[model samples]
Target: MRAFIGMDFDKGLKDELNGIQKVLKINSKKGNWVPSSNFHITLKFLGDISEEQVDAIDRIIKSAVVNTSPLSITLDKLGYFNIRSNQYGVIWIGIKGEMMKLNAIYGIIEKEMKVIGFPKEKRKLTPHITLGRRVILDLPFSQLREQVDHELGKEFLLDNLTLMKSEEIMRKRVYTPIKSYKFNKILEKNHR
Candidate 1:
């Protein structure tokens, strides 16, 4: 199956992201915009794996998240990664807040997955939510960025880590959660 590990956004966060997309749409001439329903923060992208591997992944998630509390993060910056050239690329909203905790959990998952035969990720993780792909702006990026509401500034708890399946249905990308692992509930309650 085509699968990955990710965190689903809460409704409030999704709405905020949607607002950002709307701004981008007004400034950009063309791009494949990500629907708000499809908005998520991908922790790891496991392109394809078998059922047995999925089971191993489950164990990895369970062990990696043990005693882990709900993670808090915020939408802090707007940026893009040049895909083909510097002018056109993937636009994203960068994440910040409680990053040290988030990185620790990500490191555990990366290491454990490698032990199970998955190749280690060479690049350091940059936590961000993709807003669009193959995007070309109508104006200079700095001008377009000024039009976006980049600093969402609201902090939200990431309560669960989900194993997601990706499929193209009716020519649209769809992400379905095969399973979700909730973080430490008692620790979560203590924080609030």
Candidate 2:
């Protein structure tokens, strides 16, 4: 089965993101825009893993997340990945807030996952959710960035990390969380 690890968005965040996507779609009119149901923050992309691998991954995640308290991430800015010369596609919204905590969890997952065969990421995590692929618009992506560059409606509370299953239905990819591992460890209260 195809599987990976990621975090889901709340309804309000999803709605807000959908509205942003709506405007981008209307403006660009050319791109593989992600469906709202498919919106998520990918922590790790495990292309295809066996059942045994899935079990191992679940164990790794559960063990690692137990030490982690809930984290908050904000929607910071609009950005994109360069697809070709002068064409920067793969539009996305960047992350902010409680980033150190997020990075710590990512590091733990990377270290454990690598022991089982997953390759370590060459580049550091950018921490963004892709909104569109192969995007084409009259103006440059830099120009578009200026237009949609706004702070988040609210911060995201990540109480859990998920092991997700990826499936193709009617020629479209659908992501569903098979298991969720919550971070229930208590943090020391800060005293003034």
Model 1, range 49-100, lDDT digits (tens) per residue? 8988888899888886777888889888888888565446789998899899
> How many clashes show up per model?
0, 0
CA lDDT of each prediction against the hidden true structure:
0.85, 0.81
Cα lDDT tens digits, model 2, 1-192, are: 898888877677777788788767877847888999888888899998887787889889898777788888778888788877544478888889999988999999899999999999888988888888888776776767666766353687767789999999998989988888677744223210
Task: List residue ranges in candidate 1 displaced over 4 A.
Answer: 83-87, 186-192
lDDT of 2 at 111: 95
Which number leads on lDDT? 1
- Residue 56 in model 1: shift from native, Å? 1.1
Q: State in Å the error of residue 27, model 2.
A: 0.9
Badly placed stretches (over 4 Å) of model 2 are 85-87, 151-153, 185-192
